[model samples]
Target: MNRRGFLIGLAAVPVITGAGVSVAASRYTPDYEPLLARLLALQGKTLQSSGSWNPSQIFQHLAQSVQGSLEGFPEHKAAWFSHTVGPLALQVFKAAGAMQHPLDQPIPGMAALDPALSVDYALGHLVATLQNFNEATGLQPHFAYGNLSKADYLAAHQLHIEQHLSQISVVA
Candidate 1:
């Protein structure tokens, strides 16, 4: 109620808000570099998938999603969904700094992934795709999430990779 007390409360507002934001960001922050490094380390090893796709398919699928972010998704959710539910879902994921989806679900409208590809080759493509995504200046619209800023896209890709990586285990 006093003038000094009011000013102190105002000053504390940002610090308190920033602390919450920092906590949320840290909680949802994707470990993109480490995850990629782990994938790179898996080169030349016999990696197995615990999900529906083989290792090669998983890598290829991930590559497609990354590439789609830069080049454009071949398919999209219905306009209503993209405008409504999709953006809301993205916000929720961003707030938590993570995304959760069914592990084995395929990207809408992507061509069927090749099951016979070698893991090394697929891994190479995925790495290259990730690098390209990192360097991209302009991005295309997401199929389900619709338009997103570069940071949002990067976060989304990190979450996507994290989900896929959960199924890969080294067999060697």
Candidate 2:
């Protein structure tokens, strides 16, 4: 193949491998001001003395679930280029996963984790995952999921967070 032809073919390989999908950067950063303001409103009012789910707990649980899913990916698959519903789901799940901790105070169940560790655990995880994804494959890189990209993951992640936020509103 001519030089230009060879380069074109080379570029096609990453696409074939599912590493060329475009992923948009995330826009839904956790807004600490609003979140903190809401939390402040609950100050001094004890969480209802029951095992009911709260936003903090829900966020933590979802974060852990995302972490677990990421951990399950085979090392070989980490860089594998493919795209499908599964990869899309994984991407969304990864975006949703965070590692935020109680930024200013100790969380009620943060006994094992240092109180200081509760600093945006979930958002931190999402950032790390984005970094990993970017390093693994540039924007629009091919993956198992067809056209699956970081942008899709971030969007899904944001949607998940918004959904949970709505749930919190209902409970509150």
The worst-scoring run of ten residues by lDDT in candidate 2 lies at 99-108
What is the lDDT for 115 in model 1?
94
How many residue pairs clash in each candidate at the backbone level? 1, 35
Q: Each prediction's TM-score against the native?
A: 0.79, 0.31
lDDT of 2 by residue, 25-110 (tens): 23234443454344345433423312244444544544442332344322223443443454545444444444222232322232
Cα RMSD (angstroms) for every candidate in the order listed: 6.2, 12.5
Q: Tens digits of per-residue lDDT for model 1 on 87-130?
A: 76766666775678987788988988899988899999999998
User: What is the total number of backbone clashes in candidate 2?
Assistant: 35
